[model samples]
Target: MFISLNVKFDLFYSILAPNVIPDGFVDGRQVTEKLLEATQLDKNLYQCGNTKVFFKAGTLAHLEDLRDDKLNGIISLFQAEIRGYLMRKQYKKLQDQRVALTLMQRNIRKYLVLRNWPWWRLYTKVKPMLNIARQEEEMKKAAEELAKLKEEFEKLEKLKKELEEQNVTVLQQKNDLFLQLQTEQDSLADAEEKISKLVLQRGDMEQRIKELEERLADEEDQAANLNEVKKKMSSEIEELKKDVEDLESSLQKAEQEKQTKDNQIRTLQAEMAQQDETIGKLNKDKKNLEEQNKRTQEALQAEEDKVNHLNKLKAKLESTLDEVSLWTKWIFFNIFHSLL
Candidate 1:
């Protein structure tokens, strides 16, 4: 029965190693080492007889030549190694399958919970809160509208009161101004009546003054004429006095002329002697004129010499002017050449 168990173990190991074993079974450090060592051994080597002996061999010739005890021992050892490798691989595969199935179950449970979560939260928690928030918003809007209305009402009341006061003030000021205007009108009428009376009195005074001015002008003219008449009378009296003195002087001169006629007869004899003396003086003056004519000819010769000297000076001035003109022409020619 032990040998049969050993054969079954060998068959199981063969199937597990080639087909049934999972890759994760050899992932551990210790199991990987054993798997690698077993893979290196010759697959054809075996131990077949009772109390088998093992061999390390690769070719069929080497395996066939091995002693029966060595061959059987090698086969049994290989079978044991293969059994241990397959058991560990099966255990690791079962563990991984268990873990995969558990994870799948957990994911299924999470999917179910998430799928219902929103509906539960909305019905149980959020609906009532949203309704309360909407009510609060409406109440806030209504309160704001009420506040605005109240403020407008107060402002309107204040404006109405101010308008009433302004109307009363205007009416009072109008009444006072009307009374003052009436008083001013009465005073203006009295002043106008007084001005009219004064204007009449002024006209009468102006007429009297005009009449007095005319009378005064006439008296001044009469006085001026009287003064002129007095001046003329005084001048006539002076002329009459002068005429009397002339008449008296003429009467004295007539008496003196009668006495001078008597003296003229004596003077006529003295004049005949003086005429003879005058003829001798005339002959002496005629001889002096003939000497003066010779001296005048000598003075004329001296004046002619002065005239010739003045002519020579005028010729020298003309020569100097010609030289100045030539020099001016030369200077202008030189200046024009330098500029070009």
Candidate 2:
């Protein structure tokens, strides 16, 4: 987000009054603060150059890396968005200064015309000159005001960049969440397979225990031996049940993780949808601003034509005023000589 205030200051001063040039430095920091005041943007969010302000400089540069990743024009969109915003800011600042300068010129012309009044009292004649001086002061004030406005314009521009970057950041987060959800789902599927195998093993153990019980019932004469066999089988059955329990616990944990992932995915989806809405609104605003810029350009061009006409008229008036002063001075000289 960079703004360039490239006014021809030298030409401006020469046109206003050849011998007078206003002295001041363009306080980039003060201008930046003023531009961001309404937006409440932090100073760290941007950097100010002599005529340019850059926003999210590092982030913007990082985005260029996406060009080879086939992310499909998103990076370009961000660039164009910022560029358009800068252009709009520039146009607005120019429009404001143009209006102020036009008004000032008109006021100066009024003073000049009044100063030419041939029958006015000495005090009355002096008053117009004083007013002219005052108007010059007002012109200086107007320049200062223009600088403030330029900064204010930057505030809006900074907000625009922040909003767009936020949308991009949200999208990146959503993609990461989606990948996590996929991994959780795959883990859940593996857990389900392990649980199915455990259930089949438990069924096999139950069948073996039933067979051992029938054998012991049929061989009471070898009751001690059968008792030993039943004890051994029971131990094996207990071990299988423990294995099944562990598998069940593992399955439950996997299911819990899957549920958590699903919840996160849903939440991120909601945020992405909201961001989409915001981006849409911003796109609309961009269109409106473009239209406004077109109109402003046309208006500015018309104003330039009017200013040229006025300047030509002013030149002729100044020439006539110079001739009138010479005639007045010559007549006074002749009268003084006659009296002597």
Candidate 3:
């Protein structure tokens, strides 16, 4: 078998070319020793025709040349070695891709499943609370508006009542003035008839005429006092007219205020209704967000369970690899001793 190995040694030598041969390999101990020594010098080396050669790490040129050999055994080993190296390289690439993919998958899964979990909870709980706060603010504003409207309405009502009361008072004063004017005119006519009767009596007696003259002077003084009273009444009538005009102006102002208050109440009622509708919509949206939060929670739980299961599988795989390594070492030791 060793001589047959030398038959196509040139092919192997080229494939397993050594960069530096070891100092003590001039006399070979065994095939395995020579192979081990050649590998130590250059791990890419392969054996053929009692020599070693190196091939590039990923090239198949040497293996292709060896395939032309008619002997199946020699060709088989060369093919096996090339296939093993390629398989190992391919496996390593797959492992790297798997590791990268696993990390990427884990990160993607985490973000997809867990990243929004807290955000969902915040949206569910905090959004509703914010909505409630906003609704409360709106309610407060509505209440303030209602209060302002009611206050203005009350003020306008009070002012209107006051104006009506003032108008009634002015009318009463005018009626009193008319009654006083009638009484004054009746007194003036009675005084005129009494003075004419006094004049006729004065001509009847000389002594009586002297007394009558003094009485006439007293009557003239009373007429002068009446004229002064009439002048004062005329000034009072003018002052009452001014008061009536002022009352009319106040009545107009009160009516305008009442109209403004009515408008304000209408506006407040409209705004309050709008706020109620907005609050209802916000409440509905809050409910929907809460349902979404529940679904997110369930999804996060499922992802956590999957990650835990994967961790267990990875631990089991590591344990199996350890066992395989120990078995391989035992087999290698046995084979080495048997060869010795």
Q: By TM-score, who's the top model here?
A: 2
Candidate 2, position 321, lDDT: 55
Question: Candidate 1, 166: how far from true, in Å?
Answer: 2.5
lDDT of 3 by residue, 105-222 (tens): 9989876776468666444433343344454555465555555555655555555555555555554554454344334334544544554554444333334435545655665677
In candidate 3, stretches whose alpha carbon ends up further than 4 angstroms from where it belongs are: 1-227, 324-340
What lDDT would each prediction earn against the true structure? 0.48, 0.57, 0.51
lDDT for each residue of candidate 1 in 1-340, tens digit (9 for 90 to 100): 1122212233333321334333321212233223323445443444332222233444324323333445577789999999999999999999999999999999899877876776664354334443444545644654555455556555555555555555555545544543443343344444444545545554554565455556556656778766565555546545545554554455455445534543442343234234334434444443443344344444444444444544454455456556655766887999999999
Candidate 3 at residue 110, lDDT?
70
Name the candidate that leads on lDDT: 2
If the candidates were sorted by their TM-score against the true structure, best first, what order would they fall in?
2, 3, 1
Candidate 1 vs candidate 3: the TM-score winner is 3
Candidate 1 segments whose C-alpha is farther than 4 A from its true place: 1-136, 208-340
Candidate 3, backbone clash total: 9
Question: Model 2 — TM-score against the truth?
Answer: 0.42
Better of 2 and 3 by TM-score: 2
lDDT of 2 by residue, 151-269 (tens): 65556566656666765776676556445544544564565567577567757766775676576556655566677776776677667667657756775775676577567656655
Taking all chains together, the TM-score of candidate 3 against the true structure is 0.30
lDDT for model 2 comes to: 0.57
